[model samples]
Target: MPANAVTQIPAAPADEAVRHFEAELRFETDCWDTHEALSQQADPGFVLLDVRSAELYAQGHVPGALNLPRRKIIASRMRQQYPAGTLFVTYCAGPHCNGAARAAAALARLGYPVKLMAGGITGWLDEGFPLERDAAL
Candidate 1:
């Protein structure tokens, strides 16, 4: 038998896997879940931030998401816009882009709760969600 990549490394024990997966949920949310939360609830309990460039953001971005590029995630700006207890969900172009992660890190450093929207814009579109265009800053 040949050694294949799938089994090259043994899977973690059930208990370890459970803990790892549970922890991941804390830092990530999928596009479908994000869309559901936004559409179903009047107060979704989190702010969705599009961390792409202003130009890209204007072209098209997740509905209800504010265009706040990763570099523009300033502590003072965030504080002024949202309360300290606000939870921030950030997304970028897609899986190929790390803007969401960068924005999440910035938000965390500013003492805000943050989560990365896995798959980002690509994921949102894949889920058949609509994007809002010509959004103002």
Candidate 2:
């Protein structure tokens, strides 16, 4: 190598790079499509979890979402009746809020599978989806 030449870096291993990319893709896909197919499941293998305060949830939220804040992940009282393998999709006020991420983490720690809704409630609203003010019972 010439002293004046800059050393070039090698490309990442194909398998490693693909696996990483696939992981990110899957997560984003799950987030971006949260509203599109959530209700079409015949067996309903997932639950929409609204990680906001009761007041906020009462104002409006994705239809069929349960108002269970992130802090209540371990309480087990607010969860809807779903199978053990059910996925929990979480959302908050909007992209500016991290409640969805925090809720996902909290749910994971409590042994519940979870995902964050991309853009949170804002994304769902921006997509022109209908919102329900009726709080979950």
Instruction: Give the whole-model CA lDDT for all candidates, comma-separated.
Output: 0.92, 0.76
Error of 2 at 3 (Å): 23
Which segments of candidate 2 are over 4 A away from where they belong? Answer: 1-17, 26-32, 75-83, 135-137
Model 1 TM: 0.93
User: What's model 2's overall lDDT?
Assistant: 0.76
Evaluated at residue 3, the lDDT of candidate 2 is 45
lDDT of 1 by residue, 15-72 (tens): 9999999999999999999999999999899999998998998999988899898888
Please state the error at residue 113 of candidate 2 in Å: 1.5
After superposition, candidate 1 runs with Cα above 4 Å error: 135-137
* lDDT per residue as tens, model 2, 1-137: 64433446656799999999888764543434776576676545677889999988998888878898888776365355554656878889888999888988887776677767787788887887878896453
Candidate 2 residue 8 Cα shift, in angstroms, is 14
